[model samples]
Target: MKLLFLNWIFLITVCYSEKDGKHLEVRERLKTALLQDYDKTLIPLMNSRQPVVVELGLSTMSMDLQGDGLLNMTNGNILQWKDARLRWNPEVYSNITSIRIPASKIWIPDIQVYNAVNYGENSFSDSLRNPDRHLAIVTSDGKVLLYTTHKLQIRCDVAKTVPGPGEVFIDRGQLDWPWGKYECEISMGSWTYSSSQIDLKPYLNRNYIEYLDQNNSPYLFTEDSFKDENVITCTRFKCCADLYQMARFKFKVEKRGTVTAQGLKLMKKDDKMLLISPFLLFTLVIISIIGTLFTISKLCHRKPNFLVE
Candidate 1:
């Protein structure tokens, strides 16, 4: 019993030491030291020639399509990049591994949704403009992450994607409406800088994409979920060499509360079977009744053949 008790005490100490939170004083000191000489206007690269490697990924919340070739996508953007200016030694501040500061005090990539339609309630440009509205998490090794939600309204040529059930489209004019799959592209990149300035990259994995511990993260929308059915795909593209470092996210959105053509056909066939089954049963019953009546009439007339006893 004594040995078991000692073992439990040791385990408690080890667990507590692994994930300890720091004090406010420790975080404040580190923040002041880092931001004192930080320049928010300039890129955080040590060498001017070296490109700032920015990692970007999205967690799609929901997708909705409109009748006018528009696709509304609600997504969460995870943007992270190393800042040479935000580095600090955790030993100086109570073994603090990370700190949070107002986003206004740091430099962030001027990312913009290139294919945005700029429609109502979609202020993509201003989403990242006001830095004071968000907080930046800076690790001891100078990694900065800005995790926030973004609403995107993109223009998709739905005519190309409008081939419905039993549809053989040879021309765009034959495309139908309100009942087909729609494909849309959300292209994001630095608005003011070229590819040489900001080198764009995708999230390292689900961990960085969630910007939290994968196992314990509350935000359930994940990259693995999208990969299951080709719902979302992220690719890096450029118009030419040295152009803007853009990443295009292409995904398909189905019509609201609708099923596939094969499914619709299956339902129709099922309905027809349902409608015809009772009639078939009734016909069989009527034929049986008529045959019984004919048998009785023959018996009544053939009585003289047997005997008149």
Candidate 2:
């Protein structure tokens, strides 16, 4: 027993160390990205253009983690900003031609989430109707892969994938939590969906999904797991209407809440509107004071009182 206890302690220490290391690495990268101009890394080809313009929004049902590491949206649709001028000049990347993301960039582990998928008597057709529509799994590394009988394939980073029965995938992020939703987006070719518009406040306190958008009503689980026609029914959601409306193809919308190990939500406090900045706030106050003084001075100096009397 002593030996086992020692081993467990060692393992925990190692895990903690690794987690700290990863956090440090992320912090460093973020710092570098902030300090050094990203344009410096761009190939010359991109450098010739005017200031690089980037329009960032919370993609539908997605979140955007800003450089400052703030959680910025909830709804699946919110226009963050119009073509905002990029801080880095575009001319620095003139030598670069094109950028291609490698598969290794995505990391998703296949872990079976208990009581997630639910296969019920309800027909698949009732969910949605489209061959292109199928269940896809999300991996730990933020990659969403389509589920098949054999294995999952990592499609484009932002491509939409349909869900199927007994097919469980990781949710890169969910739409619950008090502060706000996760920050990410789905960029399909030229289109983008932001999460700034959707209401994800309902998902924070609960673990199992109570409702799914596709299903028009509430979903109830019979047991932790169930097998129907070789398909497993895992969880249920109530009032799941229009869950599949965003998909290009038609699919069943089951009313069920989310079932995942981690309930994703933002804990940090977000910045206030423009008035929050000390400099801006101070400036505005000064201006208001000056204006008030000027008005009072003008009124005292002349025309008003004696002429009116």
What is the per-residue lDDT of model 1 for residues 1-309, given as tens digits with 9 covering 90 to 100? 999999999999887766453366567777789989678999876776898888887766556566676666566787899997888887888888888888888898898887888733535566688777778898999999997776777886566533689865343225545555555567777877776678888776432222222222211221232343222233344654445666765545544333343332112312221223445657889999999999999988885845877
lDDT of each prediction vs. the true structure?
0.66, 0.28
TM-score of each: 0.63, 0.17
Error of 2 at 101 (Å): 20
Lowest summed lDDT window (length 10), candidate 1: 265-274
For model 2, how does the per-residue alpha-carbon lDDT over 1-309 read when each residue is reduced to its tens digit? Answer: 999999999999999999888766654543343334433222112333332221111111222333222322222211111111122222333322222222122211112212112222221221212213343232222223322111111111221234788655543333222122222212111111112111121112222222122222222222331222211112222543222111111112111333333432221223111224455557889999999999999878877656876
Report model 1's TM-score to 2 decimal places. 0.63
How large is the C-alpha RMSD of every model relative to the true structure? 13.2, 26.0
lDDT score of model 2? 0.28
lDDT of 2 at 17: 100
Candidate 2 lDDT for residue 289: 100
